[model samples]
Target: MIINFSNLMFITLNIMSTLYMISANCWINCFLAMEINLFFFIPMIFSPNLFNMEMIMKYFIIQVTSSIMILLCILYYKNFIFNLILIILMNFCLLMKLGSVPFHYWYIEISNIISWKMFFMLSTWQKLGPMMILLYNFNEYIMIFSIIMNSTIGMLGGLNQISLKKIMSFSSINHLSWIIASSMISEIMMMIYIFTYTMMMFFIMMKFEQMNLINIFQLFFFKKKMMIMISFFIYFMSLGGLPPLMGFIPKWLTINKLMENKFILVSVILIMSSLINLYYYFKIVYYMNLNKNYKINFFIEYNFKFSFYLFNYLIMTNLSYLLIYMFYY
Candidate 1:
């Protein structure tokens, strides 16, 4: 109860700091808010001591370096160009915060060290605070850089991961490109994609937890059909954007927008990347279908009955919301 309460408090404080950054006219206050946000997360991540001390040390170094960069950038942000520099620093800070590429080693290590619950929070909720902070400082160039680098590296790097958590972390990164790209087209599309991605990820994470499944190939032993269904939910079609599914919508819109502007190479790259990226997701599918015998690999006892239902409801509701908004709005 105490830990949960403290977690709640930290989350609440971080959120308030983000809104303070958005509403604060004073630059000092804004940077302070960001600093508070950064510090709060470090404490939360380190509080358990479950992670490798080395990982904690590395995380601290990277975070402090990025924080200083943001501080210096804030000092120089007196005009548009300086603001651009600040934006770069701030986005880099988020890139650091979320463990996106060029600074992605932390993610690979952290997932191995931390608990899955912590991983889920770090992967999803921690990203939200940064997204809120970033929205106030949007520029097209920043979005483009974020999309291209995040998409290209995130997808390609994720291809080599065997840990389900690391794969999901990179999966989150891949969707980050789509989300950032969505901002370029329409707010509705962005919201829809994020909502769907979050919901689906919640299901995927919880399902993996319940099954005591850690790595990808472990799915091969689950005789339960429900597990297969869950695997399909994650792989075959997500919330309207992959291909021949509802999840394909945002990707289509994004590609079309880029093409209209004659971004032929970029479009081709994204398409090619997606084709390459689908391999791992399909691998899980193949493994789940290969073996008929169930051999439980997890020692930790888990009951996923409630989580499965909750996620089903969320996926359906969010998908419905996406359809309605796209059709009517």
Candidate 2:
């Protein structure tokens, strides 16, 4: 309901820049598109709130620094004595941009102050352009190191967080490892994983926003609402990559692909870290399911909202179609 023309324009331009990066043949074009996308996105996160201004500043500083380094590396690529150093530097910059481990401090801090809508954008769309650029000339050794670090730190970071935003921030980092790994295997596989992740996060964020939830404890207030409970269970479980759910497909495929390519150690590490991710996800769902004796004046009617049915329908249909396609062919 609070739509702004300027915000819409920024969103469009940001998306266009992302597309440009994806199709760009050269590193210069990709870097330019990335900077444009970052600038466009910055305006959308600005607000009158003082705390949010700090968040904006931190995000801007980190992204600009990374951009500067990447640009420097690109400009000096021809003169550099070793191509390996350039690849490592560029890969590190992209990893920093993606908010993977070792560069994730800024990411978690910024997410804490942003709105849920911005959090969705930060976790999803903002990552696409940099990730696409990363595919151009990634270093295998650096990527493997990132895989190990991200899988470990991403899980450990979320273990004790009471804030929902922080938990999801860590979750995004954990998922980023899978995404980076998938990109190594196949671009198409990465796209499918990203698509599924975006959809699951979209629905979960919608539900959280609708209920005005900010932390794990807030879930106690909605325990009486069956529809909310059920929806939370489905979406969170899917996000955890549980089998028979839509989220598991991309993960299963990624593991299979990794094993196929003989990345057995990385595959095993990812699986172990995923189980830990699932642990925290299940902790959240458990919090929602816990019975509470508190009473409130307002009552949620037995009938559910339109969103509940719509989300469930989409999940079931997508899972069925995916199953048939993956197995049939």
Candidate 3:
């Protein structure tokens, strides 16, 4: 156990060094970073929780395959083809990491088994380190592939999902695509995308915890129709990229930047994909309002519709202003 823990610690340090190297934008250094990120998850497979063996095995194989690709790309420095192949392979692994289909098998399984907080870390931070390396090394082409992968899978897979965890996983995938989209354009879009995604996700997971609601289907039991409707509308609308919400900020920037860069086809595809996403988002809205099957017993001690009162005004105000700032920005 000590040996395994030490090895994991060492691999994590290697990953950190690689991230720093890539952030400097040196090509060879970036390749090293990719290789390190690919290999660092190996020891995670040896974890004793012993719950997700199959998923861990799959993740291990995928990471090793991706790492081998990166190493080969490094060996043949002159061949851009290897570099491209390496990028695509690593991108494929990241898609799998982020739980986007058609590589989404491990996503649901591991998430189902892991603690929510660990699941949150896996979905958010673990992906970020590798993603930062990708952006630093090969932003444009890699980002295009990421955007297509994320938008296509997220919107289509998330349709009609009732499981809250699964839905949040797909939502994470979509927002990740948004981050990839922003990365292609400029540094500022990337920054804003990261910040907004973090804040949005913080609210989502917390709200999920507060409601003690297991699935999106149970969201109707949240009690206060007045506030539930409002909060749910804000959340879904933000997800839908509706006006003045914080969610629109990234999309607004993405579309403008893409048009400016003359990537019209990809831009159009993404916009239409957002529409596909909205189709499902509205379904939640429909159920939240029109569902007469739910018992509306109000919780006297804690209202899940709004957050704790100390944060109540502050959270609501900022959320509403996402709409305002969407227009303003």
Candidate 4:
């Protein structure tokens, strides 16, 4: 009971912090909200493992450094002549908070040491405060540079990674670029992208935890399970933003918005990078399907349990929401 109550408290505080950041009218308020968020979330991820200790410390140091920089920027944000420099400084600080490139090294490194649950928080909920604050003073040139670097680096970074955690970390960065792009067009689109991403990420992280998989090679063991492979295929494809999937909708809308706004170059880069991202996702799927020596049976066994159905239900829910979104707009 005590543990549950503590968790509930932390969760409530975390949500409140994000709300504060979103509703903040000034830079100081945003900074305070971010700090509250950072402090509240730290205790949730606490564990006895030595790696967790290392990861927590690293995370703490990075967040503090960014927070301090953000505070300093707010203090010196008076001169119009140095407005551009201040904008760059503030955006860089928030990007560091969001784990966007080129300040993404700490984000990727710490991902390898944390549990799936922690990583989920790191990639999804933890991003909301910083992202909302980033919009407070939007910088177009820096955003474009971030989009280009994040997409390209995320794709190339994931291609050579064997650890699922690191791959997802890079993928998270890639998705961050999309979120940033959506923010450039419409905050509503950014929220939509985030909602879909959080849903997909939760499901994927759950699947990984259920299977106890850390590396891509472990996926080979599930080759005989047709349902598992099919589900994984669906997840990866959606994540890669393939056509007719829920994930593709946001990207399509964002790219369309970009083109409508005359950001043709950004749209083109996003498309090409998405294709490359899909290549890696498909490569992983290919590994799941690879079995030359064994005669694979398509439906030897069906693990039609609650979790399996729940996963399907989640996918259907996303598609249903997409349908509604499309119908409305």
TM-score against native, each model: 0.78, 0.92, 0.72, 0.90
Looking at candidate 3, the ten consecutive residues that score lowest on lDDT are 309-318
Candidate 2: tens digits of C-alpha lDDT, residues 1-329 = 24689888999999999999999999889889999999999988887788888878888998999999999999999998997898899999999999988999999998888778889999999999898888888999999999989999988989999999999999999999999999998778888888888988998887777777898888766646555566777788888888777788888889998999999999999999899999999899888767754354356654556566665857733555475346523
Which of 1 and 2 is the better model by lDDT? 2
Model 4 CA deviation exceeding 4 Å by range = 1-3, 79-81, 222-224, 291-319
Which of the two, 2 or 4, has more lDDT? 2
Candidate maximizing TM-score: 2
lDDT for position 307 in model 4: 65
lDDT of 3 at 271: 87
Error of model 4, residue 245, in angstroms: 0.7
Which whole-number lDDT from 0 to 100 does residue 220 have in model 3? 64
Model 1 TM-score, 2 decimals: 0.78
Residue 145, model 1: lDDT of: 71
Lowest summed-lDDT stretch of 10 residues in model 1? 235-244
lDDT string, candidate 3, 48-67, tens digits: 66556666777667656655
Query: In candidate 4, what are the lDDT values of residues 25-65, reduced to their tens digit?
Result: 98788888889998998888877888778888988999999
TM-score ranking from best candidate downward: 2, 4, 1, 3
lDDT of 3 at 191: 65
